[model samples]
Target: MRKKYVIIKVFKMDERGVKLYQPDAQIKKGWLSLWRQMFSELIGSRELIWRLFVRDFLAKYKQAVFGVAWALIMPLVMVGVFVFLNRAGVINIGTTDIPYPAFALLGLSIWQVFATGLTACSNSIVAGGSMVVKINFAKESLVIASLAQALFDFLVRIGLLVVVFVILRVVPAWTTLLVPFALIPLLLFTLGLGLILSLLTALMRDIPHIVTLLTTFLLFLTPVLYPVPQGKLFAILNRYNPLSTLIIEIRNLVIVGRITEPLRFMIISLFCLFLFLVCWRIFHLVEPRMAERV
Candidate 1:
């Protein structure tokens, strides 16, 4: 009877009897493991991404008077300003092989993709705060949707570019067909920086303003209007500035049927790819905390 009365069960618990098997509040994870989980989650959320893109695409033009023409306005304005200045002798941009209008338009079109895409993605997380808080979805979807919108705008501008090409009677080389491939580095670099900027903007509202200011200044730093410079200082700058190489290469492919710096383009493309993966991982890891901040 005494031996039978001594039955006891042991349960795993903290000192206060809280279950030790409960899910961790935060887990330490290796970078590789985190990337695998992030990618898996993103793959599963592909439908959500497409839906979000459609929602954003429709919403963008739903009430706009000009519709997609708004995409044309910025590049047109920039081109107009510089063309006026050049014609008025306020500036002397060296002669371009193509018509000055077409040259500037081509460069602006490429630069706009990077500039607008970065701006859109950087603001996406904060802009979607209501949905982010209320819905269960991958936040990466917002960034991707914004990028898709930028791409849509880019495609629309391409139509205008064709008109410019036709008007100027500028017959691009066969390599012109390959010009689209040059967007690879621009997309990777923009997406990489955009992810990081989105998180920073979410935490600190001032980031968007800073980005706006910097973007305006960056145009001059990049060789969008003026030709790539010849001085040793500028030579070094152009060499290091990835946009310079990318834009120059695209122009060369279309106008000259050659790539200016093949090795540099390849190197920058790889660097951008690496940057995107790492920034995306950081974004994924920090995403759970975004709702609270925003």
Candidate 2:
């Protein structure tokens, strides 16, 4: 016993190193511990998030001849087209005394942001499948990157909007300060819906097409091209459509220089938050499986 001795050796493995040890069990254990790991991974990848945002920004304009200038011009052309249509009486933007172009453009701007964000995020995981499968990073980063791209586009459109406001001599009111506040719920609403749709699309593959159709229908349901009519049904739809309320609130603040009805704000904000929390829970639950599916 005094002369005999045993030596045990341990080795660590790297990406290229031969595997020295492996866990054989398939069923994941320690639910709380797994969640903590996921959360920590997300927090640690903040720099990666910034890089993703920059990549999305450049990717949008890459190889495009006009580059970011296209962003400035596209909205003007859209507004010009709307003006022509409204002046020609092709589409009647409802009863406000504001110029049809201004009214339509304001609503369009908000709708476009939400729509673009939804569309981009819904397809984000499918489009970034390689990263989802091979990379050890937050899956939510796909949706966040899509949103960052949409936000950049929205900001560019806002600059064009300011130019239009000046050209039309439209004076923004002090209430315009609330515009950013109004945007909070809208972004939350969009993010919630986007995350849900994106996850569904990743599974169904047909959901993206369905989402496109639904968005088209929602545009009409919303008061974007026209005002919400004053009737029981229209009023009900308007109140229920988060985008409609968000757009209406933004327009009221920026164009009419008034805060939206407090009750409406409360309702919309609460609804948005509720939807966001629900979608967030769903997202976290499904995210761990995304790499396998993608």
Candidate 3:
């Protein structure tokens, strides 16, 4: 038999010394692009997201006189205002199963996770415009990274919650471990809404100002400072409002030892997941144009 030799060729850079990566057709816009974008974003941008998270986290407290103290300030201010209002007969929070201070603070802590995360993620692209245009990287990292600040703030408030429990001589339920499941839907809801707002905010500068006003209005509309109302108006609003359901359930889990409405929370969880997918799809399709818009 005659001896035969085969030679294999390895892909090398062109004469100009530039390496070419294979184009990913799946990344283009389509119905499935949403899942592709999510996979790319979550899997591919893991390290980038962490780096951005760290950068934003450090920069947030770097030059501030109060440093991380600012994280606790807003919730404390709300607590004080509500306490004063309740005392002066200006407003009635009604009866809570737990102490008013702990009840309100617990609700506010979870609410801030949604509120602050939404606000930061909404401005992520606009705030990081210089880098958005200059860096060729996953844009969703900006939004995902913004959640780190909210999570950190939430952890700080949790410490305050423990103090309130101790001072008030109230014991939280064993069901507190289930709080994370409740929080996941809230995070998804915030991210879904944030992605839509961030895209719009990048294209239109006025969106952030509008978001600020909306956040203030939403706090009152939500049942954070008060017990869930039984009036016709509040009943209808709570029926339609997803945040109310999540917050109320989380508050119940922590204070009352069980979820008040398991079915409602399950529905909201599904809705939030669907909403996130739709928002991500729109964001993925529009992302190519974002650098120019910003």
Candidate 4:
């Protein structure tokens, strides 16, 4: 087998108005030049990302009658089932700091940002399809643009959250302002996993479907619809699951004005940042080959 190489040119200009040309190092060859290359492309392609984001955002709602309402509807339907079950005493979801409906809805809204972003970003390369083969650009743009749709849906669902709060007559804690800051780690973790998964989904077409299925299963395990269980088997799972801590910390901030485990939250946030950096580098290194796979 032969190795494939990409030649990168680094151009520097000195005071004499002469150009100096040097060869950039490959990351696979364990060099730092690729980092500069990737950052340059990512920063330079902001307009391209916005264009792609707008195209996808419009395409999603163009033919749909309900449009953004589906965002609120789906979460409401899911939470409604749990609300009914708890009311019927078929299962105890445990007491929430706010009403159960409010608590579950808030958790699911935050969770959907990760779940939807993961599924969307994983499919992004394949969804780019013809354009990816025909054009040359940073493939990261596709995954990043795909994430914008989920964020739009998340903003739309904020209306439902406000409605729930008004109806239940529950006032959120002042620390609710910190919810967005807490969510930064969750978003980073999702984008990191999604960046790697996007490449995989191109190689194996079924990966996106599997990702969707896994996210659905994880909903039951991650305490989106219930309070953290006490000393149960799941408490251990919650203790380590980054998503659980992210969602729970945000929720507690909304209701209690405090984070239950500030140290744990800080640790998970750092892990998320590390994971995102590693995954981003992996994506940048392999992106040239993605066109062939897709």
Q: What is the TM-score of each candidate against the true structure?
A: 0.88, 0.83, 0.89, 0.90
Clashing residue pairs in candidate 2 are none
User: Of 2 and 3, which scores higher on TM-score?
Assistant: 3
Estimate, for each residue in 1-294, the C-alpha lDDT of model 1 and write its tens digit: 432211111123346956332222224334354556578778998998889889988898989999889999989998999999999999988889899999999888888888899999999998986888888678888998888889889899989999999998999899988877778878888988998899889899999999899788888888887777677988888877888888888888988998977898889889889999888877865666666677
lDDT against true structure, model 2: 0.75
TM-score winner, 1 or 4: 4
85, model 1: CA deviation in Å?
0.4
Among the numbered candidates, top TM-score falls to 4
Question: What TM value does model 4 have?
Answer: 0.90
Q: Candidate 1 at 35: error in angstroms? A: 2.2
Candidate structures ordered by lDDT, highest first: 4, 3, 1, 2
Error of 1 at 71 (Å): 0.6
Q: Is candidate 1 or candidate 2 better by TM-score?
A: 1
lDDT of each structure? 0.82, 0.75, 0.84, 0.86
Off by over 4 Å in 4: 1-30
lDDT tens digits by residue: candidate 3, 114-190: 98999999999888868888887778889988987798899998988898899999989999998987799899889
Q: Any residue pairs clashing in model 4, and if so which?
A: none
- lDDT per residue for candidate 4 within 1-294, as digits (tens), equals 855544433334346857544444232543465567678889999999999999998888889999878888899999999899999999998778899999999999999999999999999998998988899788899999988888888889888999999999989999989888888898899899999999999899889779978999999899888888887788788877889999888889988899989999999999999999899988976666666668
Q: Candidate 2's residue-wise lDDT over 1-294, tens digit each?
A: 544322111122346966342222122323454446456756876887788889888877998999888766755677788678877899776576466666777787788778888888899888886877888567778887787787788888788778777887777778878787888888888889988988888888998888789878998789876776788989887766777878888888887787557788778889999998678656865665665776
After TM-score superposition, the amount by which residue 175's alpha carbon in candidate 2 deviates from its true location, in angstroms, is 1.8
